[model samples]
Target chain A: MRATTIHGPFDMRVEDVPDPVVQEATDAVVRVLRACICGSDLWAYRGESARQPGQRIGHEFLGVVEETGSDVSGFRPGDLVVAPFVWSDGSCEYCREGLHTSCPRGGFWGSVGSDGGQGEAVRVPFADGTLVRLPADAVSDDRLLTALLALSDVMGTGHHAALGAGVAPGTTVAVVGDGAVGLCGVLAARRLGAERIIALGRHRARTDIARAFGATDVVAERGEAAEAAVRELTGGQGAHAVIEAVGTEQSMRTAVAITRDGGAIGYVGVPHGSGTGLDLSTMFDRNIALHGGVAPVRAYIPELLTDVLDGTIDPSPVFDLTVGLDSVPYGYEAMDGRTALKVLVKP
Target chain B: MRATTIHGPFDMRVEDVPDPVVQEATDAVVRVLRACICGSDLWAYRGESARQPGQRIGHEFLGVVEETGSDVSGFRPGDLVVAPFVWSDGSCEYCREGLHTSCPRGGFWGSVGSDGGQGEAVRVPFADGTLVRLPADAVSDDRLLTALLALSDVMGTGHHAALGAGVAPGTTVAVVGDGAVGLCGVLAARRLGAERIIALGRHRARTDIARAFGATDVVAERGEAAEAAVRELTGGQGAHAVIEAVGTEQSMRTAVAITRDGGAIGYVGVPHGSGTGLDLSTMFDRNIALHGGVAPVRAYIPELLTDVLDGTIDPSPVFDLTVGLDSVPYGYEAMDGRTALKVLVKP
Candidate 1:
């Protein structure tokens, strides 16, 4: 089977690898249909994150179950499914609390002994807990397929940001960033009935999609100007919720500055550059609530999948470019060069 | 008029000061009956925070309205009242949203032009917004006077911690300090119907008071051991809510560790050592919600005052020692040396 592997910084290759097999009683072997390159993956490609040569990569994919262990009672071969980025035993306390990312028995894809999602066939642990089955006819629809693929990570993550920020009917939300997650945050805020959604982005193509994702306004500004633009839009009080999808110090600071007193800042960006140090005095003075971490994608996938299936949302457009499995490197390049908002790889 | 002044670190003195006068149309002059030495005030006394010579010191007080400006309609002469630690205009958007501490026109007591609450008579800005009038009988009841004093800062701050952590019936709460505020947190959590309240303290007197305040258990451990004890108490899952009342990095880290995945850590400690920096990766991985700042005492005073008036709560016990204005320096010394859990001063 052909799988994506990283040899070093800016080095990605499709190479022959052994097909995955269900080795554990709770495992299932999934044949990949679609996989997407994540923005987080770029960290390693850009030498920001340490990666061992020949390490398997990618954690977002949708596929058909090719085989299942005896203990996997809820799923069987030939069923189409979407697996969350992290696999967990659904019965753990954390999982029961809908925080699967913190599940005691869960692990991320591509971690030691697990198969990466960007491969022809991958073994999934805790199959019954990790995979959500989709209707048979749904797999035949290309649009729904792409949207369902997003539910595996990006869409679920964006939804987590909105939920963490306490976005609700009639609340105003400001989404910071023009990346796929940020655009999805705009969509999530709209779906949650936010009265106003402001997208802070500098890029024309991304901002256009942000508008399509239900951003009520777009501010192509950075730093203090971006914060001022949001405050201006919100009657000088700032938004009730601010979604921080870019995890840089400046972006985090901006998120805090533009959130209304007593409002929340939901940050889902993997922190880069410096350690996440907040201005405690400011946060304390304003009583701003900071909530968000890795999205519990497994907890949110089912609901987002419903939205995708019903055509209530079409997050598929975030995948601005598509390529074959052999061209996975090109997908990475397109995303890295800013030519593609997100890249979809069909296996 | 007499007031408490800080000449320098460890240099508190009771000295003659000019009588307060109502200068603004919205101002009032209040004759302070009771003022308390707060744990935070010790920061300046201990040289942890900078203090200018002859600076007025206190911010927590209960008193009788001595005089009011023409526009101060909500308060009248001789009416007993409690003033929040911070004064606000009550009309700003932040104030309207119940975040009076962040009101644009508000300022902390004893800051520059503002009169300190520790004086015999002090001018209060935004009288209509800052002073909550109690029944005249409250002035005669020493117990009620003390409890009402707590409403100015400590008790309200503890309540804010519980509220920020989302404490409710059936939730387990761990309070990470044994100070007046932390003990008040135990009381607040119980008042909110928390199923189990764990008070983390080693002092016999404070722990006894914690039990009296409804702490179901006491964990006499610090740092990792404290977190371990909390986890063990909650069946290795940690508490649903943790109140971080001590602002040290270790205390904050313990609060985060003892909070269950997806739980909240409400911290009210005035951050002292390096800026409040959290392990964002850990917080993110666990989906921990960090919420808290200065308690919006004005927002909570009304409801908490009802609890005091009805005899449903008696927070006066937190003021274990009482002294007169002449002994204000002794009050600071007692608290500084941990000889008293809290000090009450009568002007």
Candidate 2:
């Protein structure tokens, strides 16, 4: 089998690797049909986030079950399913609370010994808890497949951001970042019935996708100007809910600045730079709530899946480029270079 | 008229001042019957917070309405009332949303030329918005008067903390700090039907008050030991809700550390000192939600007042020392010296 491996900075290779096998009673071998490059992967690609040489990479994938261990009851051979970025034991307290990311028995894909999602096959632990089965009829549709693939991470993450921000009917929301996650957040807010969605992004291509995702206004500005634009759009009060998907200090500051008093910020961007630029005194004075983290996408998958299947939201637009398994390195480069919003890899 | 004035650090004096009168259409003059030295006032006393010489001090007070301006409709001259620490225009959007602390037209009680609560009389702005009326019969009872005074700030602030942390029936809550607001938080959590309350404090007197207010457990250890003790008490899962009533960086860090994954921290200590020690990465990885700020006490006074009037809660225990008009300076010294948990002033 061929799989993606990281060999130091900017060195991604598609090389022959042993096929994954179900080794634990709770595990299942999945033949990945779809996977994608994630923005977080860029950190390691740029030598910014430490990575062991020749380590597996990628954490999002949807596939067909090839083999299952004795204890795997929820899935079987030929079952179509999608795996959340992290695997969890569904019965743990955290998992029961819908925070699968904190599941004690859970671990991220591509961690030291785990199989990466960008590979041809993945040995999924806690299979029954980690995989959500998709309908057989939908597997044949490429568009639906792309949308379903997003459920593995971006879509569910967007939903988590919306839930964190308390987006509801009649809410005015502002989303920071033009990445796939931010675009999906706009869709999530709209699906949750937010009356107004303001997207802050300088990229026209990404902003167009944001508008398609239900952004009523776009602020193609940065820093203070962006804050001013959002406040102006919101009648000088700022947005009721702000989604911070960039994870940079400035982006976090913009989220804070553009949040109305008593508003909330749902931040899902992986913190990579200097601390999130938060002034506790200001947050205190304004009564702003800060929530979100590595999103518990598994908890939100079921409901978001229903919407995706019903044509209520089409998040497939976030995947602007596609590549084959051999071109996985190029996919990473394109996303890192901002040439692609997200890259879909068909194995 | 006599009022408590700060000539400089450690220089609190009872001096002759002009009597308060209705100064605006929304103003009402309040004759101070009960005022208390707050933990926050110590900041100005210690010269930590900036203050002008001879500035009027104190913000928590309950009294009889002495006079009402032409447009003051909700209050009458004889009405007994408790004024929240800050006055707000109830008609503002933020005020309507129950975030009076962020009300654009609101102002703190002792700012610049405003009358302080520890005075013979106060010309309260936005009379209808800032004050909550108490039953006429209760004013004569010393105990009831003390409890009503607590509603003017501490009790209401505590309620804000509980609400911000999403306190609900069966929640396990932890309150950080042993001051009046923290003690009141323990009571507020209990009133909200929290099944278990863990209070983190070092002082015996304050912890005793906390226990009486419904804390089921007490952790006297500080720093890492306190975190370990709390985690141990919660079966290593930490508290479901944490109230950070001490605004120090250490207290905020402890609040974050003891919060269970997906838990929340509601902080109401007026942030002092350096930045709140927050690691965005930790908060993000744990999915911890941070909420709260300077409490919008005016919005919570009504509900807390109902509880106070019904004898359902008595926060007056926080007032361990009492002083008359001329001894207001002694009250500040007592609180600053830690000889008094809180001091009640009669003028």
Candidate 3:
């Protein structure tokens, strides 16, 4: 089988790797049908996030089950399914509380000694607990497939940001970031019934998508100007809900600054810098609520999936470019170069 | 008139000051009937928090309105009233959102050039916004008057903590700090129907009050031991809601550590140390929500006043010592020396 592998910074390649097989009673073998590159993957590509030489490297995918172990009762061969970025035991206390990312027994895909999702096949542990089955007849629809594939990460993550920030009917939301996750956050806030959605991004193409995703206003400024623009748009009160999808110190600061007193910030961006740059004193003085982390996408996938299937939201717009297994390296380069909002790979 | 004033660190004095009179159309002159020393005041007493020499000091008090300006519509002469720590215009956007502490026009009591609560009289700005009227009959009951005084700060502050942490029926709550606010937090959680309340404090006397206020368990441990005990109490899942009433870095850390995944920590303690010491990375990975700040006690006073008047709660137990106006300096010493949990002052 061929899989995406990294040998160093800015180096990606598709090479022959041993095929995955069900190794435990709770495991299942999934033959990849569709997978995509995540913004987080760019960290490893740029050597910003630590990665071993020649390690498997993706965490979002959807595929058909090719084989199942004895204890996998919920899925069988030929079933179409989606896998969340992390795998966890279904019955754990944290999982029951809908915080799958905190499950002690859970592990991430593409970690050392594990199979990556950007491959021909993946050995999924806790199959019954991790995979959500999809309707088989819809595989012929490419648009629906892309939207469904988004449920593996971005869409659900955006939902996490919205839920964390307490987005609700008649609330005003400001999303800071122009990436696929931020665009999806705009969509999620809209789905949650936020009356006013403000997208703070400088990119025209991305902001266009944001507008389509229910952003009622767009602020193309950065830093203090961006915060000022957002505040101005919201009548100097800032947004009731601020979604911080860019995990930089400045972005976090902007998120806090533009949040109204008694409002909340739902941050889903993977922190990349040295410090969070969170001014607790300022946040304290403003009565701002800060909530979010590695999003528990699995907990949100079911609802988002229902919305996707019903055509209530079309997250497929995020996948502006597509590639095949052989061009997986190009996909990484495209995402890292900002040439693609998100690259869809049909394996 | 006489008022409590700070001469220097560890030096408090009750000195002669000009009697207050209604100065603004929105102002009212309150004759101090009851005033109390707060834990936060000790910050200035210990010189940890900056204060100008000879500055007036107290923030919590209840009094009788001696006079009202022409524009003061909500209060009049002879009316019994309780003043929240801060004065606000009441109609600002932040105040309307129940975030009076963030009101743009608001100012703290005893701040430089302002009249302190621990005085014979105070010219309260925005009388309609800062003071909640009490029944005329409240003066006859010492215990009820003490509880009403608590409403001006601790009780309402504790209620803010519980509300911020999202405490609800069937939720398990943990309170850090054995101070008046933390004890009131235990009572607030009980009022909100929390199924199990864990009180963390080392003081025997305070812990007894915690039990009486509905603490189901008491953990006298600090730091790691405290976290371990809380986890054990909740089957290693931590508490659903954590109230952090101590402003030190360790107290915030403990609140975060003992919070269950997907749970929240409501911190009302004024951050005393140089840095918050919050590990955002850890909080992010664990999905812990942090919400709180200087409590909007003014917004909560009306609700709490009802409970105080009806005998539903008695926060007066926090007042372990009593002193008269001339003895205000000694009251500060008692609270600073830890001999008093809180001190009630009569002028």
Candidate 4:
């Protein structure tokens, strides 16, 4: 089997690796159909995050179940499925509450001892809890396939941001990023009936996609200017809800600044650089609600998958570039160099 | 007229001052019926907060309207009323949203340009916006008067904590303080139908009030141990909501730690010392929601007033000591020395 691995900073390669096997009663082996490089993954590629040589990388994928362990009852061999970024036991307290990312027994894929998603084949633990099945007739269309692949991570994450920020009918929203997840946030807000959607991004290509995804306004400014633009568009009051898809100090501050008193900021970006420091005085003064973390993709996948299958939304445009398994290195470079919004890899 | 003035740290005096006059068209003059030393006030009395040698010092009071300018129409002379800690214009966008504290034309009482609530007579700006009328029939009872006074700040702040944390039927709540506001939070949580309430306080007197106010459990431990106790009580899952009434780093951290994943922490304490710094990594991983700031007392006063008038709750018990206007300096001492939970002053 060929799998993606990182040797060091700026070093990505596809090399021969042993095929995964079902090793536990709740485990299943999957043959990867599609995988992609995540914005978070670029942290390591750009030397911003530490990673040892030969480390498995990638945590988003869709595949076909090749083998199932005896304890896996909901899924069987040859079934098309999408797996969330984290695997968990479905019965835990957190999982029962639909917070699977915080499940006590859950773990992220491609971390320390787990197999990465960007491989020809991989072993999945708690198979029934981590994987959502697709309709048998659905897998034949490449366009729908691309959309389904997104439900594994990015789309679900964007939905989380909208939900966390309390985006609802007749409200104005500001989305603070142009990445795949941010664009998906715009789509989610629109689907939820937000009266107005503002996308804050400078890139022409990404802003165009943002508009197509339902952004009613696009602010190409950064920092204070971006906040000023949002306030101007909101009649000088600021947006009712803000989606922070980029986890930087400036992005968080901007999100907070452009949110009206009693409004909420839903932030899903993985924190990088100097960690977030909130001014308690300001948050208290305005009564702002800040909510978001890692998305519970497993909990949201079922509903989002239905939307994808019904053609209610098509998020495949986010995958602007695609390549074969052997070109995984190029896929990483495309995303890191800002030439591709997201890269899809076929295995 | 006479008023309470701070001459220096540990030096409070009731001295002669000029009588308040209706200066602005939107202003009204009120004769103080009662005033109380607030927990926040102790910070200045103890020299923890900086203050000038002679500054008007109180901000919580209920009074009778003595006079009103031509523009003040909703209030009449001799009518009893309660004022929120801050005064606002009532027509700004923030005020329209019920966030009066952040109103564009608002300012806090006792600041340089405003008259403090402790004086014999004080001028209130934007009277219609800052004051809520009391039922004429209910002002004759001392007990009811004390409870009404609580609505000006502490009790309303506690209600904000519960509301901010999304407290409702069947949720387990943990309150992290033993001050008047924290005890009021216990009462508010119970009033809101929280199934279980855990109070984190060590003082016996305050713990008794917590129990009377509806705390089902009390933990005397601080820091990690307090968090451990909450987890143990909740079967290692943590509370569904936490109310943080002490604005310290340790209290905030404990509140965050004991909140279950997907839970919320409502904090209303005026942050003192170093500002709160949240670890975005941990908060993101747990999906904790942080919501709260200064209580929007005016927004909640009506409903809370009805509760007080109907005998559904009696917040007056928190006023454990009483003193005349001349003894306000002693009232500050008693609270600063922990000799009194709260002190009510009659002018």
DockQ of all candidate complexes = 0.75, 0.76, 0.62, 0.71
Per-residue lDDT of model 1, residues B1-347, tens digit only: 88888888899988998889989999999998999899999998998888778889899988888899999889899999899999999988778878899888898887766678777878999999889988898778888889889999999999999998889999999999899999999899999999999999999999998999999999998888888888899999888898989888778878888988889998888886424447777888788888999999999999999998998777888999999998989988999999999999898
For model 4, chain A alone compared with the true chain A gives a TM-score of 0.97
Which candidate number would show the highest TM-score if scored against the true structure?
Answer: 2
Per-candidate TM-score against the hidden true structure: 0.97, 0.98, 0.97, 0.97
Comparing only chain B with the true structure, the TM-scores of all models are 0.98, 0.98, 0.98, 0.97
Considering only N, C-alpha and C atoms within 3 Å, which residue pairs clash in candidate 4? A284-B293
TM-score of chain A of 3: 0.98
lDDT of 4 by residue, A1-347 (tens): 88988898999988887788999999999899888888888988888888878888889998899999999999999999989999998888789989999888899888876789888987999998888898876678898888999998899999999998889999999999899999999999998899999999999999999999899999999988898999999888788889989888778888888988888988898887314435556777888888888999999988888888888888999999999989989988899899999999898
Clashes of each: 0, 1, 0, 1
> What residue pairs are clashing in model 3?
none
lDDT of 1 at B296: 90
Candidate 2 segments exceeding 4 Å error: B273-275
Candidate 2 C-alpha lDDT tens digits along B1-347:
99999988889999999988888999999999999899999989999888999889889999999999999999998999989999999998888988898888899988899999998899999998888888998778999999999988999899889988889999999999899999999999999999999999889998999999999999999999999999999999998899989888898888889998888998898888424567788889999889988888888888888888888999989999999989988888898999999999989
TM-score of 1: 0.97
Residue B72 shift from truth in candidate 3, angstroms: 1.8
Residue ranges of candidate 3 with Cα displaced over 4 Å: none
Give the least accurate 10-residue stretch of model 4 chain B, judged by summed lDDT: B273-282
Q: What share of the true interface contacts does each candidate keep?
A: 0.88, 0.88, 0.66, 0.86
Task: Please give the range of 10 consecutive residues that has the lowest summed lDDT in model 3 chain B.
Answer: B272-281
